[model samples]
Target: MTSRRPLPPPLELPKPGFGRRTPPALFQPIMGLFGLGLGWRAAAGAFGVTPAIGDLILGATSILFLYTFAAYLAKPLRRPATFMEDLRVLPGRAGLSAASLCLMLFAVVLAPYASGLATGLTLLAFAVHVGLVVAITLAILRGPEEGRVVTPVFHLSYVGFIIGGLAANALGYPEIARWLLWSMLLPAGLIWGASARQLLTRVPPAPLRPLLAIHLAPASLFTMVAAGAGLQAPAYAFSALAAAILIALVVSARWLVTAGFSPLWGAFTFPLAAFASALVTLSQGQGAMSGIGGIALVAATLVVPWVAYRVFKLWPGGKLAAKTNAAEA
Candidate 1:
């Protein structure tokens, strides 16, 4: 009998370039800024301050949304394994949250210019957002005990729901919005409490210290969501709490920045934008606070582009992940 020849092992392709290494979560800060800028511009129009600025910011938001959406769509084709890998981990899973936020932001931006298109986009985004949130929540619940590290970024998953609720309100679905908002309250509180406990117990690694700024995001985002839903009492209360958290974060800015220029710095961008947006919402007609909100909005606008530029420069070269790993080591 002739001996059967063994088949060769399957070929393993080399990892794709920096582009493939780019996480969907990387777009979170960029989209957050675009959303904040769009909101501020709308506020400006409402106040009769600079209606032209609204159009300008809207154009910018459109450009960013298109670019980011294209990149995310291409990601699966470029690296099929990334999707499954991201699903396997807590931190990587936050990418879905970022994707949901980006979709909602797109819906918001599209609303004024194209009502039918905006409604269609909002419906699509809402469906996707709900699916992702439920999936991520289940993963966490069924995950191993060690997988439940309560880092600031983990809160992004819950933040996604909050943003979706706001988007629902914008789409004129107050009941749905209210349901979404209330549903997230317990999860958000648990995450915040766990994170706060972790912080009190142990200093986070240097690479992760930058994410401490993320602690401010939930309160800031909730304030805006509450205001959007016309819960004035809770909205104002959350606004005060958000301001306090912002001040505390600012006081520790030196310690936070001492980590310096890691990709993790992206953690700082979205939270600041959330705070500024919340302030703008609170300042609707309040004189001095209005001036303060305008200033905060301008500063956030400038800072976001700088952060985006840094992320882009490092991301394309694959330095962001490399630097983060080296620091952790």
Candidate 2:
């Protein structure tokens, strides 16, 4: 019998350029800090703290990354040959690009409405948002196709961004804001629900499966915000939307135990959940005092440290098997 030849092992590739390679730990902290900044901003705004520092920090960090990411997209102008050809390469990441656009657009509209430092920051934030959105969308449209499974998760990121903006606005224009909130929430809720179901049923591989699993936290947080916002928007529209967001958060929090957190991934949830809490709470108020979201403000503030501790435990390079197919795929 002829001897069989062995196939080559899979190639391990770096993301592309020196700029893409920030030390994972450092990046995690930076991302987490931004998340914390966002959460604090939500709490302060909900409680009627003027000169909203949390809002400023959140806007600043957001604008910085938005601009930086946007700059990355422009590289193709120099190296036309390096352009991405497949959108599926990173899957859910593309969804995030789409979500960022939603944020940038909202910021664009919000800038004109907000006062003080927020005005200038909001304008810059909008520009950055626009740039990042365009770049990521183009990247996904051009990137490879295999990793597209994660695409839904990326879209979910928009849910978090929008929720933050909504909380900041705090029923700014009850009818218009409510419409915008529901517009994004309905599709997001359906898509996330369906996606989570599929992932669970299929029993996807590690890394990704777990990554997708933790996504529920952020998803739940977004739903909470949506429901809270809806209830505030108009009592008539409250029942359905409120139920959806509330149910999702409750069910997902339970799932969080088995799935656990990933510092890298879990970082997304803290601020999001906090913002949701603040919004929902703030919505509970009536008339002038509506700014004070009460108990929700307190609970949401606690979530930051709680999520932070859990996140540190699950961060990459700890006991968990960091090298699952998802990170590579």
What overall lDDT, based on C-alpha atoms, would model 1 receive against the true structure? 0.69
lDDT of 2 by residue, 206-320 (tens): 3333344334334334434444445533432432343444445456554534544444343344434334443434444444324433443455445544654554454334232
- Runs in model 2 lying further than 4 Å from the true structure: 1-35, 45-87, 91-151, 157-175, 210-267, 270-276, 279-329
Q: What is the C-alpha local distance difference test score of candidate 2?
A: 0.43
Instruction: Give the 10-residue window scoring lowest on summed lDDT in candidate 2.
Output: 320-329
Candidate with the greatest lDDT versus the true structure: 1
User: What would the TM-score be for candidate 2 when compared with the true structure?
Assistant: 0.51
Clashing pairs in 1: none
Q: What's the CA error at residue 173 for candidate 1, in Å?
A: 2.7
As a whole number from 0 to 100, the lDDT of residue 116 in candidate 1 is 82
TM agreement with the true structure for every prediction: 0.83, 0.51
Residues 242-302, model 1: lDDT tens digits: 7887888889888778767766677777788778777777778478766766776777778
